[model samples]
Target: MRTAIVVGAGIGGVATALGLGRAGWQVTVLERAPQLGEVGAGISVWPSAVKALQQLGVTGLEKASVVSAPAGMRRPNGQWVVKASALGLELPVMVHRAQLHELITSGFGSGVTVRTGVTVDGFADGAVRAGGEELRADLVVAADGLRSVVRDALYPRYAGPRYSGYAAYRGIADVELEDGGGETWGRGRRFGFARLIDGRYYWYATENRAAGAVGDVWSAFDQWHDPIPELLEATKPEAVLQNDIYDLPLPLVPFAQANVALLGDAAHAMTPNLGRGACTAMEDAAALVRHVTGPAAIPAALTSYDAERRPVATKLVRVSRNVGRVGQLDGRIAAAVRDGLLLTGGKVAGLLARRRSG
Candidate 1:
């Protein structure tokens, strides 16, 4: 029987392992954390990601539920800048990252082995060194993450992720919302909120700074505008989760080498501006499984994966970064221009819809 080793048990890693196991590969998943959990607060799972989850038999989304609704954006002063329906599907269905992790982890059957508290240092040929133990397999999938050690071994010249010059402060509060999701754009600052399935509002704020914790991030937004202060003040400090935003460079040059292949953030990391980060990762795992287990040669399958995903994902990364600029526009004139463009162009509506679809 074919054997597979997947590094990292996060969304991408677990999904890949589950897909491969379902495809008849004996799989082992290595996770550094002692126990699996979600890193960020709330993640928006769009239709594309949902489709992939359905493929993997992740049937617990409704049970581990966060709120589901259409998403919108506003200015710092609390004025609506842009609004759009989620269309046939909900723009975002809020779910705790940890619950999502649990959903994927539960899919690993007898054919899959999961190792927690184990860190993968590097990989060579068809083997990975994890926690000082060497394990070999017919194929190694590096679903590790942005700082993927496997990716570093495969392409050291690529270095690692780059900071997007902004940090996001996130939290969830038991506040009454209008049953919708919203984002407030400010000068080099941004804030947004969504109603989670648990009936709590998931909110996040962004600022121009390095990727790390800051003192009193809510205090930083105290003077911004309406609702901003209310949202921050109403929440407890313990609930807030903050991290700097970063993205991997695109054109991942060569996504594979012989029996090894990169997936998820390891392959094409990008900003969350479009909220397609996880969705794209799920798509990558789904696409790879179809090819690898469908009678195509390893090299040929990888070639097609790169060909099909590179152009679409590269475009997404570029567009997402540009959207970040739009959200963080500084200066009075720049803000005015952004507002004008959004209101007059009516082009943003379609662009946003496309983002959700991908």
Candidate 2:
């Protein structure tokens, strides 16, 4: 029986392990965290990732997540800027990041060993060095996220993850809002609120701030009208998760050596502009499962996986960066343009609607 080792045990790593285990490979997952959990507040799962869930026999995202088509943007006042019907194939769903992680981790059973608190430092041809142990495997998956150990050692020339010059503040609150999803744009910033799986409202705000800076979620956003203040006030300070958005430059070696491949943020780290980060990782895992299922040589399987994933991930990295510019638009002129776009009815939806179509 062929053995595969996956590093990280994150959404990407767990998904890859489940896919490979189901395809009859012995799998071992290494996670550095003491406990397998995520602190991120909320994530939007788009159709591309939903397809991956369906492929893995996962269903009822509405049960595990909050399902609401984005109701479009509005001003700080109670005026509608834009409205949109669910145009895409799958209605966008938002869920707590930890819940989604739990769903992915639950799929692993026998033949899938999960090791928490173990860090993978580097990898050679067909083996990984983790916790001073040299573990050999037929396949090594570098799904270790933005700071991928394998990526750093294997593709040194490839630029590492860079900050996108914006910080996001996210939290889930007990504010009693309507059961729909809504986003309101302010000067150089955006706030999104949605219902969660547990009947609570998940609220998030992004602003152009210094990398790694903790934001004043309430004081900074208090000027906004309506539920913004209420939601922020209702949210406990401890519940907020602050993140500095980061992304990797593209066109590097998505695959390395004969027995190693990269997946998810390890391969193409991108901003959460369209919430496609996890989705693309799921696609990579699925494509890998398909390619390696046949009796093809290890190199051939890796080639096929890279062929299917590189172009898409590259495009996403670039697209997410561009979208970040739009969402993080600053200055007087840019804010006016953003407010105007949201103020119009169909015009705002017409232009911004296609952004998530990918």
Instruction: Tell me, by lDDT, which candidate is best.
Output: 2
- What is the per-residue lDDT of model 1 for residues 323-356, given as tens digits with 9 covering 90 to 100? 9878877788998899878865545555766787
The lDDT, on a scale of 0 to 1, for candidate 2 is: 0.80
Q: Write the per-residue lDDT of candidate 2 for residues 82-128, one digit (tens) a residue.
A: 66563233467878888888877777779799889998887776678
Best by TM-score: 2
Local distance difference test values of all predictions, in order:
0.79, 0.80
| TM-score of candidate 2 relative to the true fold | 0.91
RMSD of each: 3.4, 3.3
In candidate 1, the residue pairs with backbone N, CA or C atoms under 3 Å apart (3 or more residues apart, or in different chains) clash, namely: 66-197, 67-196, 67-197
Q: Looking at model 1, how many pairs of residues clash?
A: 3
In candidate 2, clashing pairs total: 0
